[model samples]
Target: MKDKIILKVETAGTRVDAYLASCLKEYSRGYFQRLIDMGHVLVNSQKTASSCRLKEGDEIEIIIVNKENKIKPENIPLEIVYEDKDIIVVNKRPGLVVHPACGHPEGTLVNALAGHFKGKFVPYLVHRLDKDTSGVMVVAKNEKVKASLVKQFQNRTISKEYIAAVGGNVSENEGRIEAPLGRSHQDRRKIVVGPLAKKMAITEFKVLSRHSGYTVVAAHPITGRTHQIRSHFAFIGHPVLGDETYGGPLKIGEKSFERQFLHAHKLSFTHPSKAKKVEFSAKLPKDMAWLSKKH
Candidate 1:
């Protein structure tokens, strides 16, 4: 299917690609630039360069060509928390990959969503939870909703809370970890607390309960980063239990865990279409809940 978008420029001097990206928040400037290069974008009925400056009242047209989706829909079950015309909230289960990747080409959440919404609408991911992390997640039903949600994430207006079972006793009732995180030089796959192309990562946490060898803490990541909570806790010598990559023990006492003890417990953000604040919570899975009952 091909969709055409036409816009009349209100502000002048902005580049065509930039203007289009701003107007159609769902697409990126680079994407618009590619369209311009392919002669799919036009200004006043004439093909134009991506860098061409726009004038007030200039009529711009964008032709979006949809390609055949290669990802097949699978009838995988999902724990849907809430759904509406614009978005779907789900309590993502552990060990489920959110999106398809190199080794994980199918059986993903996206594929399942496709199956669920088959013939209705395509699901657009605004944010992601790790493959092993179980928690509240939201998916947009359309590009307009996706753009609004993406903007909220970019502005850090979306609030998130996580429950983590980490090794060792946390001395303080609450504390903040303000550290920079970047990809490890030695391991491209690993993220670490360092200055190598670093971006500031901050995590504020409160000790919820203390157990024999571990502590369950409520973590609020002030700034999102790759593995921010795991990396920050590991930096403080308190790697999350079951996180082998971060030095966490696979077994704590008699119980064993197959994945890291991190759960996205709560998420809050402004509703894209409602223009109202909304929040969602996911109950702790059996494994994580098991730790809370222990003395």
Candidate 2:
């Protein structure tokens, strides 16, 4: 089905992509850019590039070409942290995929949310966490709220904190890793730093405790990138414990570990409905907690 929307710009000078992202909170900037690229979005009845700046009172028409629904809702359980009419914050457990993809076609958090919501409202992912990385995640119930949260993330106004146990002891009590990241030519699934890196990535960490040969630390990623924290730590020679993809140790101090020791402990963002700052957090899972005790 196609949904056509026409609006007259009241403010000038905003990029078309930015304007669309702001107005359509449910879709992402990337989605909007894709639309523009496909000539689904037009300014004054003429197709325009996503980077084109808008002029006041310019008429914009957007043709939303929605994809056919393919994902099926499942009866999977969810650990909801916070919920409102606009958004839902969930404490995602390890081993659960955030969304359905190639290998995982069902039983994802999206499936759980779809079942939980029961089609009363649409569930849109604001961000994501790795399958093995347990943490707090927020989902938007409506497009407006989703757009607002997306802008916050793009502006770096949202704050997030993670906890990870790295192999070997870290020398610095607190440090920052500012490096560019890019996909490895050698391994398509892995990421690399330095000249091999093609995108800017930054991560900061403060050591929490040091174990026999491991260190637990709080990590803050200034930029959201695929495997940023894991790759950054690995680049620094302290790969996350149990992260097999990044050369992390599978066993730490006689304990058999199964997954990456990375957890999203805290997330803070401005509420779209309430227009106020809100923060959410989740405790470490059993394995990470046990690891801390051993350390």
Candidate 3:
């Protein structure tokens, strides 16, 4: 997919990178410089440098390519939830990585999808879930669908719901956590709620049931951030059960669980091909279901 942005210069003698950075605050100046260097940014239909000064009435066009490096296909099994010509929804299991990264090179969901649709369209992941978090995920089969789904996510038009077993009994029936999230200053790997947060993260939760020492809550994250739900719950002193990273209880009613008791229970978005809203859901995995019943 190609993204084109046209900007007409209103003031003269401003550097190209400076003007673009002022116009597009979501992107960094370094990103605009790279785009200018790559000939993606053009002035008056001609390629220009980042340091080039802009003049009045000058037309600037920026073209960005949305593409990912080709990945290898692996023969891993997939729990498909829904599929069509343009998109495929999967019930991603815990311990499954969404894509290939530095440490996780194989055995990923993308690899499995690639193998499943060999000789057909390569799957493009629209969003991601943590490796330890099992959930419903959607993949785009084509570039147009990928662009549409990505835009919907950015616009916050998609609704994501999760079911989690939290430690201790929550007193409130429903509540909202509106906090800014950023990397922890002390622990680089963990996120913290602080004034230095660059982005705002909000989570709305309702208690589903209260057990002997745990509470099951349905969470809806308004803004998707890294470990947003886990961190927010931890901040409220109700870490998810079995999530060691956030001080979640290791066992529920004397039964030990291996991973976090969080599941992406539901996902709603506009269908790119059908042009209608559709919602997909994944039932709780065996371990979580067992804990929920036993408690």
Instruction: TM-score each candidate.
Output: 0.78, 0.78, 0.76
Taking the candidates one at a time, how many backbone clashes does each contain? 0, 3, 0
Q: What are the per-residue Cα lDDT tens digits for candidate 2 across 201-272? A: 999999988978899999999999889999999999999999999999998657977999999999999999
Score each candidate by Cα lDDT.
0.84, 0.85, 0.84
Worst lDDT run of 10 residues, candidate 2, spans 1-10
lDDT of 1 by residue, 1-295 (tens): 6544445565679999988877665578888898999999989779999879987647776777774444567999999999999999999999998875435557888889888988487777777787898999999988899889988888999999999999999999999999898877686556798766569989999998997889989999988887889999999999999998889879977889899999998999999989999999998887787755753
Residue pairs in collision within model 3: none
Clashes of 1: 0
Error of 3 at 54 (Å): 29
Q: Which candidate has the top score in TM-score?
A: 1
Evaluated at residue 167, the lDDT of candidate 1 is: 94
